[model samples]
Target: MAQTSSHVDSEDTVEYWLFPNISEDGDQLQELEAFRTRCFTFIQDQSQNYIWHEDSINLKVVTKRTAGDNPPHLYGKTRYGCNVEDEWFIVHLFRSFSVTENDVVIRIVDSDGDFLLVEAADILPRWANPESCINRVFIHVGQVHMISIADRPSSITPLPSGQPSLMDAVHIVRSMPHLTIAPSPIQEPIRQRIEKCVSQIDSSLHRCNVFVPASVAALLQSYPTLVAPAVHAFCQRDASQLQVIRAMRFFPPETRVWTSVTFTKCLYAMLVHRNYQPDHRTGWTLPPNGDPKRTGSELGMKLAVGFELLANEESLHQQGGDYSLEMDSRWNRFLNTLKEKGFFQDFLESSQPYNELLEKAREFYMNSVGVEGPAKKPVILRLMQSVFADIEKFKKEEAHLPADDDDSWLSVDPATLDQILGDKFGLLGVDDDEAKAEILPKLETFLHRKSDYEGLTPSSGRKKSRKLSHLAPPSASRKTSTLSNTSDVSQLSNHIGFDPDSFASAMQGILDFALPEDNWDLESNSSCLSSYSEEEEGGELVDKEMNNYMQTMDQELLSTDVLRTSVDNPTRKESVMSEGCESFSDVENFQPVKIDSAALESLLASYTMQRGGPGPASILLNQLNLPRSQISASKKQTD
Candidate 1:
């Protein structure tokens, strides 16, 4: 066994051990409250476990809190005080033991009361070497990534003493749980089993699901060699699977998750403990690549590589929740740390491999859209294809960066970004000043509050709010109302790029596309289109009031001819526009215009005699009453 010693501030640094799984899994999820509760309760109830004959030892527990929590007792952590906004748990047990001195040995049992952890400072035989004793406790903690679908956020942490030395194994066996799961003892060395398990689980990384079977659980209890590799695979897999295992903590699905999802939590804890260290003067040095560490921006590049691999699981393809891409709940904490050092841009550039995804996205799109050549594109599909083309172009553009290690993007001017996008991806380029003016304010507001927003950008969220605003009061609705009394319908044609003459010409063309006749749909018709206002239902006689309503509709139809002449002579739009009438109705300036029945009749007679001949119009006129006396009376009123 090899041992190294270091001295710190007048004291010898005897040993530094990492107990990665003392509390709940995740990273260094230190729930001191839970630990204090267990410590106090164990001290109070199990006094005999800690008794060294008559010598009594005392431990005072102070609960440290964080600031983010309002009452300082609620959430993650705070600099000054704490109220935990979220709960995390971890367990770590390490201290020094000297058999040559006044030593105390105690057994700390897990919360379930099934397992006892031995705390031994048993190396002081005077002839015993301290090196071998310390090395015996160096068993690693293995981490499993996924738990189950329900709570995949939690991680699984294997105990620090998962595997032990020959002497250490004997001590562990004596205190081991006498569970009914293992009906037989393992034939191999117990220490070897544990070492194998931890090594396998910590070796690889992934983002796939996991499957834990009952048979494997019983075997894991008897031998520790399976723990490491199994957990490593679980974390790397996509989903989780949990089966009945009498040895492991087995909770029914009715009460809690049957599948284990605490692996990633424990793995993160292990990474932080092994790879990160604090330096008193020059901040700290992250784990450097290629052994002999160099300084400067190289440090940033190495750290970025590690972070990119850690967050490699794409959010787009993750199973379960949309947030499955979140490798750890404290992911932003890691980002904020790097952001402070101005290395976050490098980390983000390393996050997703744009070129790879871009290729696949392009292939998938081409197969789906069914378009052959770009030049033959139809106007109707132009807007839709522009979006598709833009998606591909942007992906390719982002795939290529200004630099590999140096970040030119960090200090780039916003105007430069817009110009670059416009030049390369014209389809996505927004050139409309009016649209930019409408969206820019909301976009900035959202980016300013970036910390609060999740799942989508601020601009998209603001647009949704704007659309929902249509439900408010009248003054809060659309600026121009089509149903308003002052809305003009005549001048609207000009605004729509149409005039009365063009509309009449279009109407003539429509009249040639299979002329409408009474014979059409006569058999299958359920309701008659020719039904008057006094039409009977179930042979019931219509009321006199209904006849009066019919006469009113006829008078309204007479004024429709006033609109007909306006349609026949499109030049009237200029004169009407000259009168200062702008709305759809323009009731003040043009609504009072009366229909000239003589002139309307004359116009209809001329159109009926023209080429395509009034085949159906003559038959339609034969059914109406046009008495000369009524026309004379109308003329007298006009006079």
Candidate 2:
């Protein structure tokens, strides 16, 4: 059974039928569910069919984790069934799933009813029409064809409403002969030539960042035979071979002009810059290695593919739809820039390299634009300088305008801002004497102390009036609870009665008892120690202090919940079934509580001061999945 549908707007109305080859056990359906979530975000399902409705399109997809039971739908019997809208999206699916025509029948329809039938209108059977083409056109092995109606399967059940359904189209299309129709005679030789020519590219010269132009993609989709010859010419980097456009007899007459113009501009760009540097971004490579210095198209089919690569980069910057005019503008701008760079002067046309390019351009004009053709032959040299006059003139016209205002707080000292904030917070309720008395002085002192201890003052903003060698007098610096280093050292020395000769002798005697004079590398006449008691006493004192510090740290760690809470509850939830899903549940399930970096830093600094170093802080950061190395790097950047 078949039904005909009239043409709608192809741009707004397009459909795709995906039939995946699943194993007998249907384990692949689970994988398809994952593919659906990762790629087609519109299809959200959990062991069920997902029907997506939109203004311009509709999708009925099966996104199940298992093939438990088949639903009573037109496509229920198949292992997997889904509809795709985007062309590249389908291609990605085919490649990722390793889909072949034999495994599953894939069909596409646009406003024209059948996309492939419209494309292959020149070669379809006479009996084929809108009615007959319905459910007949299918894509197999990367090629499009219309299957015979006689191949329809008998198992297709008719709908109760007496309307046609695509239930058996998959079986019929997949059952058809793999190579039902051979390549057209006209396309055969061109295909072989392209394969031979492109194969000559150096194996080491890897091509990347390649994007097919829309004009080229249309030909690939419909009239693929014509594409190879064009590609062959492009790889050769020769414009004279543009006579290949005449061979595209099956394509409409206007299509030849489109192909020729695209080929001409791209080929000419390459000829203009014969010694152009290789650009990895543009996938630019020199012509096939070991060719002649002044090589021209021997078979007259050479066209450069470089512009196709280069032009897409610009199209990507803008909305990537219909970039033919954009490519032309970019070509003109490229020539203009080269002219301003002094690549072509008055005598350049007479030079050997430019003259060769001019000759090729003339051939391109002759072949693409015949004597009776509507286009007039443009002078190649005249086109080169279509925009730029000279470097100085160009620079003057394109000079950047200065900004109107300076809205910079970059020059404001952070310390000054901190002080101002403290004063503002203190004066928040100054009208109430009780509140002012209670908050004002305490708030100011607390803020000042916090800022000072955290080293929030920028080194650049700090006054550098004092010399590094000159220590500040006691009154000049802020007082602390502990005695100054100078005072501590002076008092300790005075209390111990530190006589230089006696102190040195005692240290030498202790060292001799522990380390021995014979083991020393020095040649001085140092005697052995009287005893090892002095060295043993010092070692015992250090051990005793270390044990006390360890006991204090153990008591604190046991009392605090920092490490215990982290070990008990993790931020990111882990589960056996968890994957990289961006579903609502996955997104809402976990959200990190934001902590102020400054506060965290201040707290960590206090912990380090109490514990004697950054050892505990590093361990804490590790538990939080924030490595000390990363934190240190961030801290350095902030500083």
Clashes of each: 64, 6
lDDT of 2 by residue, 359-411 (tens): 23332223221222112122222322322223343234323422212213224
| Stretches of candidate 2 exceeding 4 Å from the true structure | 1-11, 23-31, 34-60, 63-102, 150-165, 179-639
Highest lDDT against the true fold, candidate? 2
lDDT (tens digit, per residue) of candidate 1 on 532-555: 322566332343344345445545
Q: How high is the CA lDDT of each candidate model?
A: 0.26, 0.33
lDDT for model 2, please.
0.33
Per-model C-alpha RMSD: 35.9, 32.2
Model 1's lDDT to the true fold? 0.26
